[model samples]
Target chain A: MFLKNRNIWLLAPAVLLIGICFLFPVSWLLQRSVSEPVWGLQNYITIFSKTIYLGVLWNTVAIAGVTTLLCALIGFPVAYSMAHSSPWIRKVLIFSVLIPFWTSILVRSFAWLVILQRGGILNDFLAGIGLIAEPLDLVYNRFGVLLGMVQVLLPFMVFPLFSVITRIDGSYFSAATNLGATPIRAFFRVYLPLCLPGLATGAMLVFIISLGYFITPALLGGRGDIMIAQLIFERIDEFGDWPLASALAIVLLVGTGLLFVLVNALIKIRGRGI
Target chain B: MTKTTPKGGLNRRTFLKTSLCASASLAALSIGTRGAFAAVDLSGREMVFASWGGSYQAAQETAYCNPFTKATGATVIQDGPMNGSKLRTMVEGGQPIWDVVDVTDTFLAANEELFEDLDFNIVDASPLDQAYVHAKGIGCIIWSYNIAFNTDVVGENAPQSWADVFDVEKFPGKRALRDRAYPMLEIALMADGVAPEDLYPLDVDRAFAKLDTIKDHVIWYTSNSAAQQLFVDGEVGTGVLLNGRTFDVNKKGAPVDLTWNQNIRSIDYLVIPKGAPNAEVAQHFMNATVDADNQALMANTLAYAPCNPAAFAGVEESVLPWLATTPENAEKGFLIDAEYWRDNLAALTERWTEWKLT
Candidate 1:
């Protein structure tokens, strides 16, 4: 009993911290969703009834989904290569990925603005090389938002996948080779299946963070790219509508919770298959 | 949930109760400390003056705070980029940190309950424009939103009117407008041929219809910095920008020029938040700020016209045309209806969001 309870005792500080800081404030905010401006579920009803609110909700989800997929597609190869590379090469790759994490997101977003704006370096370079006659509408659009989000979030996906991949035993690949399988075949048949857990974890982390993104989307996106976080800020700052903002927050919280459950279920099913 | 308890020691319930009491007393002690300070005489007290930062705050320090501090022997500290939500939070919490805040007149009108009514004897606002001064706020500065364009990009052909801004075929480049509902609706109405005097009780449908023509061509800038960047980076050919920001950029040798034609004038007011620790000192600060000479100095420095009409008399002859309140300039611009915005901001903002998304 003592041994089993020791770990629980160790977790008590974290539990207490979360309870006081995160859970308390969030629950208070959730309570305000129903109680402010009047008592009822009217805030929720209003959210569902208005197409604009629903549209931004859908926009947030869609952007998150695409950003997750792009990050996974780009990060998997980079993380995989880093895991399999020589030690010096691996060190260089890790350093490059972690460098962006050290810089502020605001600075990076503005850097992207400079690179992607019309008559900016990218456009000027492309035009100079005779690649295109006109500067493409790149920065203040969905493309810019996705580019900035993926760049910022790629490190999140890479680190987790690298940690998991490094843990896989090297003998597995050797064993597969001995069984007359090619390197590619061995990777798909063995390494890929083993990496699923890490892939899921990284994808889930990136998706959740992207859902709450405000600054990058606001700075890089055009008129049609309003996200849920920006909408909540507008509600609070422009209208002083705390109740409605709280309600929107609650919706995001519940949606994130649902996504967590769904991802957990899928991971469990995959775990069973493995 | 149980922890190992020492023999003959306090139970969990007793421990929790004692700790709760201790924390409650700690909070009370903090509030008590603040109350003790507030009960003292106003002389030598320190007060916070909150306003939009940058050259604006620097100008205030020179024109308002410095003189007030010299006369009253009170220390004035600067804070903030004038956020409405923070003001509401501070006032509602009953421990407002800001003694005097510079906020849009519309914001003061909307959140009147959070402000203290001004006493005319304490805060002599007689030098200010009577139309802008209210019981809850004193007029601080007047600025206009004008058509600002990059001179390097547009050359000799600058946009002269809102009609030119909306006519993409004539100008043929991206334009930026403030993301907020105000002034944009007014600009749209003017572009659609509605006279300035008839703009109040805005025809929302007509404005939105006119906006649709240039909606695709328009990029939205939510802040002054963003609007400035839009022009400096050559991302937009023209944008609606605050007169002060435009002036600052032009002074910095950025190829930006402003057209005073049909600009929209906005007034910022100095208001005291309710439950301020140094409300009386803040009132004196307000009184000192509105003196004609101080107003003129601030106007000269920031390029935002002073609220005191008499300040114009002291202003440099070369600067008069640039002042938003100058007779020639004022006639070319329409005053934004603060009352209309205070009442309809929420509904209009909702529609603005919907329209932006579309």
Candidate 2:
């Protein structure tokens, strides 16, 4: 009856589009990962076994994890301010957070370079103020990579937390305090738990997106900052080794998928217990 | 895709007048040259020419494509910003959109099977140096990664060799190095006191060891544009950069300059993709690229060295010092062994990644 329902026809276009655009390509990628250079899991084996690939995979996960953590730490405060601030201040805060989305990521990365390079504006200002004798090495390091990524991804975390924080009644905080809880304890117990859904969503968004980041890290990062995406690109672009690139892609996809599922399960379990 | 012409008579008239003037000048250039492509009647024929875009490709359009178009009456539709994988895919799919493509020596060497063999009957490779000539492609330009530095930063103490670049204690600043396995390995070996000729089958371990010596002091760049930025910004006192890129920044009054000493020469070859539709016309266009005057124009514009030796005669006196193929400069550098790279690029690149992590 559900299949025969006329409303089911409304879903046809979306299903066809996803099947054509997403599923087909993913299946093709999956097929290539196993099929090319002989039919087996040799490509995956190489990726896992090789120190080069394993190192990059670790770098990718580590960078993404750090970026997600930074986003959550920074976003929590900003989202709180947006939720609690005056109407005009909220608008200004929201606008400022979303401003980065307007500009291209490449432009933003280059802007960071201009601001953070040894001879760049930030160094000149710092040196002018006699803060230090020499310009600090800022860009072209892990710091620069994380700075660039977090700037671009801040809104992703902020907006979700803002939406969730806005819905959370302030009376719950007052009630917890009235029940003889300390302000910090009340905020942590009542406020933090309420923010979990948003924090989880934001962290997942930032981490997964940051995992596939190519330009920001490539432009800003140093020698050791190579990510899995860069490796995949090199394999495809330089070597034209599609099989290996495909295997790398599948690995990233599967890893991200597993993360999504694990987080969802944890969230569901927590929801039932509460 | 057919380009839509503007639907206005006055604009069309101006366009015709401009093209006619261009054709007239091109005709005069052909007449004055010895190796200029003889006018061929290829009316109504068109072909795609692809290269790495920006000023370099613009100069190529002026040097190679314009003359070919004018001489043959064949429309040359410029395309790309060439991508290795995209080109390979097109060829493997058996319907390459590019009739002609400009690729690095390493790429051409590695993917030789993906290219159509040059039609010797159509492409007269005589005027060009035999060494630059290949069965699969024609060497369009010879450029090199030279020891480059900021004149303002390094002052009178320009780095003379890769060894000088590696000696950070002597130079005392960050140095920009190309972030690739090929020439970096060669440069490191040469820096480690290995002779240029003995550099091949690279002592990989020795190269990595040598690279480790200055790894802290180095700013590795993946692109020449980034390398130029490093030099111009004085972020690097001395390092390695392409001869042409150094010339570009120097010409722009960036106080950046390069030494031809111990330069690592590499080439860009123009090749036809395996299933290019206009293979015949692409072969004819190769003649235009080999012409002494065209090569000279390219060298004058970009400071990329001409493959045809005779082209040097027409090159500007000032431009000569910047060219990688100048007799003196050519002697100072050795061409990177692309064949060796073809076999080792993938494996060594992985090793390079591993080395960089360490």
Candidate 3:
């Protein structure tokens, strides 16, 4: 703290980059939201009053919530195994999780369509095996959207849980079991609670990322699965309605900010309790 | 003709002047036998030509841009899979990289201010249909939302109308439709028994009601490429698709085909963006797009109907039936109302989203 005069200059380039690239554009967007189509809160008013905007907002949150829940459920066991397994097994697990991440979201979404559409490879294979007489509706629905999003977002959940679980002492669970608690009871009471911070971090990452998803939902989801990002794109691309688009973006930003603050407060409260 | 300027300092105007002088001498020598581009020679100039990339733009390059270069001596640099918002931003920033951009009629109608007015002296729109010509742009191709189907899926019972497409019992299975509001509303109304001529200031409530009946059956597609794939793969039995997109898949031996009944025609326009670096060359490029021979080549390759009526003479016999503007085909369909869409796009699109959610 005493010798920080020159050390602060090291932050100069990053600060300058953020100021020019991010902060400037964000502030400009903020200004555009209010100033366009007459200087008032008309854009925000329209967003709030309109059922279309409100519905899409609800859809975005609902989809993100479901996606986060799914990632957490699927990621927990895999992450637990990765953390507890031998070095070679851990390497294999990490590679499997990360290899898909390297592929573009657009390509992955298209791949899902190829595999999951009604006349796709899955249905053909299933029909060949006499699993069913009729092809099932797979892609182009809420289910497909979840499947696509969960696969892409699972890594965000797993890595955090893996790091946290590895750091956790194995004695916490053994101690609970020695105190006359059953294995399941000991795991739930001692182990799960200890993993909460990592779970919260991963959930936050997945939920927030899912909230702004565009390509996966557009490609995989049904008509009703339109999200806020898609709406923003349509406003700008189709109509060139920047004011409304900017207002929608600001709403998303503010909503995510509030959620983040709420989660931080909850974590602090839990810390105090402990 | 042999005059040389000082090395390394020839600006655009000076180069144009030098070319003009050279052309003047050549024209004088040729006397009464002046070729088509006798007055103009853009030998040293170059302009960027932007369009929706893929086979469509590739066909345009072979048909329009190449010929324009041959006639005018200006190089046309190909760019873009044209995106609307990016074009708007580029023009608003007053430094558009693209000189001539291929845009839809609706986009041209909505954002007229973003484009340069056509220099009538340079671009001759006389050969084209008057309806296709605009003050800010020239119609390059006329395509339509057609009642398309996979022959394999529908078997012997082919869908001939929008009503049949809406009739699940008639043509059973999942059907594809565009995810936009403009044409969807129009399509829904037409399916509900509204006449083609009567589809103006559209009956919105009635359209939604019609759409609701087939809501569960529809596979809404945002991209035309995806729509083509759907038809090609026999995933959709019958639905609405663009005429050119249908032709592309069908040419590749896909079982897909289309009907001309109640097709909704739309135009793609080539416009010079405001403050474009080579607006002069772009204006001449527009003239080349209207040439009968070039337009015929485009129609032959893509089956996107040419705006120039004379281009039909050079069109192949097989491609004639697929074209939207053939006399018999033209009588069966109507152009989409770009003005109405320009006014109602935002409001109705919101309503569309609300309807979908419900």
- For candidate 3 chain B, the 10 contiguous residues with the lowest summed lDDT are B26-35
Q: On residues B184-212, what C-alpha lDDT tens digit does candidate 1 reach at each position?
A: 99999998998889999999999999999
Which numbered prediction scores highest in DockQ against the true structure?
A: 3
DockQ, model 1, C-alpha based: 0.46
Screening candidate 1 with a backbone cut-off below 3 angstroms (N, C-alpha, C), the clashing residue pairs are none
Worst 10 residues of 1 chain A by lDDT: A1-10
- All DockQ scores: 0.46, 0.72, 0.73
Score every model by TM-score.
0.91, 0.95, 0.92
Kindly list the per-residue Cα lDDT of model 3 for residues B174-196, writing each as its tens digit.
Answer: 99999988799999999999999
Q: Model 2: runs farther than 4 Å from truth?
A: A1-6, B1-22, B26-36
How much is A97 displaced in model 2, in angstroms? Answer: 0.9
Candidate 2 structure quality by residue, lDDT tens digits, A1-274: 7767767888889999999999999999999999999999999999999888899999999999999999999999999999999999999999999999999987888789889999999999999999989999998899999999999999999999999999999999999999999999998888898899999999999999999999888889998999999999999999999999999999999999999999999999987776
* Every candidate's CA RMSD: 14.0, 6.0, 6.7
Q: Give the distance in Å from residue A166's predicted Cα in candidate 2 to where it truly belongs.
A: 0.7
lDDT of 1 at B37: 17
Q: Using TM-score as the measure, what is the rank order of every candidate, best first?
A: 2, 3, 1
lDDT (C-alpha, whole model) for all candidates: 0.83, 0.88, 0.88
